[model samples]
Target: MPTAATVPYKPANRCIYLHGFASSPRSRKAVYLKDRFAKTGIKLEIPDLNQGDFTHLTLTRQITQTAALFNNFNIPITLIGSSFGGLTSAWLAEKYTQVQKLILLAPAFGFPSSWFHKFPQAELKQWQESGYKDIYHYGKDKLLPLHYEFLRDGNQYDTNKLKRSLPTIIIHGKNDDVVPIEVSHQYISSHSTAKLIALDSDHGLNDVQEIIWQEIQDFC
Candidate 1:
């Protein structure tokens, strides 16, 4: 319910940053933002959303937890969401008027339904019936259990309808195998207020950290 216009820009400068799924506030990007913005009085709000069994909650609940960070903050917010977090940012931006800008990095436009298709129908059905399944890998040894219904529910949110003409920057890796770069391109094509920056790396954009940071600074 906290609109962007009402959020106080205490210290008169700063922005909020959100981390991706299966990742904590201690992620590389989050740390980078915090360090980079500290000199400018810009604070980053990176919450931990991976404590419990993530697959048990619905996507709405997951999204709500992320959006709640903005509710009490008095400063102007510029949301930066990566991967699944990016999808969450789209929903938050649609509902909240307080978001000044949005930065999406290799965002999945929709759930990676195709990845599920690799499983046999019976296996997929069994996983769905169980309400949980290890769907993907996160980092080195982390396995991501996904709730199919949660993805189905999240897909209901139409990103196109949340048009606020807010400045949005999307940076995607050209060689991304997880969420194809084409998805970001399509999003930018449909949203007149959005811009796209393509990198030569993969989904993680691991090698181009400095360049990506530079782009973010320019946009903000």
Candidate 2:
């Protein structure tokens, strides 16, 4: 993480970077934003939110922490949340008036309620009793246990309510499996102020840093 300069200065624009679940502020996107904004003297704050166990903290706790972090800053804030962070950002933007701009990257539209619906109550109980240890393999990345429960809890935070008539940008990959691009389209269609940008990359969009930065610059 980059240290904030000690110079007594006010930023022209204030931005908050929210990393995905199980991810930290040291993520590539957070690092990229920090480096990009350093040259322009813009303040970008990325706070650590992972509390050891994902299931231990509730969604309200996450939202409260995020809101408190923003409350400490005295400037017009723009939130950029990726994946699970994106869902949290949407909730914050809807609840907070200081959030002037929002940028969501591959945000989950809804929870995996349908998939879990098929499981019997006994099976679900057994799964939960087993510590919810479900390993998910995504290419070379291995997701740990309790992630499914996190997603299940994440479903309670409704994304549809966050569709406000405010300046919003939804950047999603066309081939994103984690979060379908159609969700972005649906969000844009529902909100008149939202703009959807479709990219040819995957959910991470790790290869198109420059393009993402340019889009953010334009929107900001």
Candidate 3:
């Protein structure tokens, strides 16, 4: 139940909220955190990773676009990312010294490798041969065409390379079906600065949002 007004803040500190894949700036968590930050006159930057085109979305494109936001500002930043965005934030923190802290929710660590098992071998081969696959976009509320390049580009980023020791907090649902809580467990085990909080909820984590917010407040 922590609000931005209750949390200590510095005028120059920057905070950006990154939504999950197939989601947008208008996502439930993004909007809720933005509103809470606004209560204390803090601006939370929520950029649409889709960039007006979800068809050709890739992890590289998202990382480049999100990193561009740090161009002119020399101030320390706090990144809050959910699902795939959590993966993005981790890379951003690795590449940029300006990112002082991170709050990750249900981070998709093993990503495409983790997801590939969900589809049959023939289905996966068909997606590669067909060049694109139909995916359910939660933000658009429809099945959209996503190119196979998403998998190829994602393979370029190895989570093993994320060795920076920036303070990080990962809140993952114990009952998450999409990305296993074991991913966070492995991440926290390797990074001494990282902490994992297992919540009693599912993947979407709508029920434990307030607890997540409280964790974020304390971590920040």
Per lDDT, the best of the predicted structures is 3
Q: How do the predictions measure up, each by TM-score?
A: 0.84, 0.81, 0.93
Q: Model 1 TM-score?
A: 0.84
**What stretches of model 1 exceed 4 Å from their correct place?**
3-14, 72-74, 112-120, 135-140
Deviation from native of the Cα of residue 16 in model 3, angstroms: 0.6
Model 1, span 42-161: residue lDDT tens: 667666665466665455775788667665545556778888788777777777766668999888675646445557999878877887787454532467777777656765666556
Q: Please give, for residues 1-220, the per-residue lDDT of candidate 3 as tens digits.
A: 1111222334478999889999999888888889888886889999999999999999999989998887644467889999999999999888777788899999999887886888899998999999999999999999999999999899888898898887899999999999999989999989999999999998888898889878877876
- Alpha carbon lDDT of each predicted model: 0.72, 0.72, 0.87
After superposing candidate 3, which stretches have Cα over 4 Å from the reference? 1-11
**Poorest lDDT segment (10 consecutive residues) of candidate 2:** 1-10
- Candidate 3 or 2, higher lDDT: 3
Q: Point out the worst 10-residue segment of candidate 3 by lDDT.
A: 1-10
How does candidate 2 score on lDDT? Answer: 0.72
lDDT of 2 by residue, 81-159 (tens): 9877787888877776667788988876654453366468787777767757454423225665653455456567666
For candidate 2, give the lDDT of residue 106: 82
